[model samples]
Target: MRILVILRQVYEQKSIQWSYEDRKLIYQRNSYNKSDLHALQWTREYKLKADALVDVLILKKEEEASEENKLANFGIQRCFRIPSNGSEKEDAAFISDLLKNESYSLILSGYETEDEHSCALLPLLSYELGIGVLTAVYQLEGKPNGQLTALRKEERGSLQEFTIQLPAAVSVTSHISKLRYHRGRSAPDFTMIEVKRQLSKPEAVRRIEAPEPNIWYADTPSEEIPQLRLLNIMGFASQSNNSNNLQKQTDHLSKAHLYFTAERLVKWLKE
Candidate 1:
């Protein structure tokens, strides 16, 4: 079986700064998405257990030496790099076209990217490739008959089990087991292939100004006596708190009768 894991480069949240004047964010450092790392770890374990071939496709702004070295240390033999166009739709289309000739039993990717927080690419790719996609998968196991059992994490801390056939794609969540380091492992001579495709220019982005802060202030207390002020606010004079007025209001309420007749009550109930 052949498994392909899609990895994306993302900016570290701690290394990002807000440019208030430009109304945009500035990125200082790049790192692998945490969920993608989990997916890679899962793929590695699956490959070891099932003796399947695993490959990684990296979507990055540019090919970096550090990233290549990292992949070599992970012992992946073949690595594919594609320039990211910063548009999910374009990237999905390009990848779908590039993967048309490849025969992979399963494809794995993170459920969502850290920078965009969008799950658009995988679904779009699945649609173009005409394959089923399972999302938010945290645990996966392969069966003897080319079937996979996946445990998906749902909202409110719930798990849903699914049985999927081969030739499917899965998006993994970050809650899976962390990656284990292999010490003293010999670095593999990995093959780095750069895939190039012409992509349309990304649309211009509009900047928006920050909203003004809202503050509430309390009303100043009146100089009058507290009891008198309370009475005035309640639409009652201090002198109108006598028992006679209260009795008159109570009598008015008691004298009020229901206007609905038996026929009307029966009609309302029927309706």
Candidate 2:
């Protein structure tokens, strides 16, 4: 199975210890927390199941060697580093283009990165990809006949067993699977594709690394607190849909009471 794992890096809480020298963004880049273990968990699971060639997608303003090093160390041979401003549309577009010519049996995503960026992207990704998604999924394996098998966490911590066909995405919580530290693994060569550079002519394949920091910094505005929403699933009847049942987040439930449709669900997800 060709698997694409999505990951992100953020400043470690209480670990961002650095002072700016003459307005340069010179904070310790290594201050990001250990979110790599989450990606490692997915890699281990999929590799054990099907020796899957795991690709990775990272949302960032630009590619840096430090970040690529993080993804490439985890047995990943490819990465889609999409430029993002944390909007749902940009997230959809980047993923859509990546899927335009290629398809994968499994797409793994970490539920919440160090800064909870991916948590907001989880539902939006499923709606935009228009594929069967099982959130908080694990114990995933492939059957002999090209079918996928997995488990989900339902309400009250009940484990729900389900199966979906090939070409499905699963959002995994960071702590669900145990992680092991890997060493002596030579850095895997990964092809890096930038979202903005897709339309331009292909550049020569060269080493991926970060350029030296500029003298000044471009400050990104702070993210505003997201407003609460309620979704109603009054008549959610599946049409023999052999799809992976996705679990819901606890606090976002709005106790809405209305008919269910994919359009409405997607609209609500974007909002």
Best-fitting candidate, measured by lDDT?
A: 1
Residue 229 lDDT in candidate 1: 73
lDDT of 2 by residue, 156-258 (tens): 5567888888687777665556766555545547787755633332234534333457685544323242221111122232323234255533455444523
lDDT of each: 0.77, 0.59
Query: In lDDT terms, how accurate is model 2?
Result: 0.59
How well does candidate 2 score on lDDT at residue 109?
72
Cα lDDT, model 1, residue 255: 23
The digit string of per-residue lDDT tens for model 1 on 135-175 reads 88878889998999999977566789999988988899987
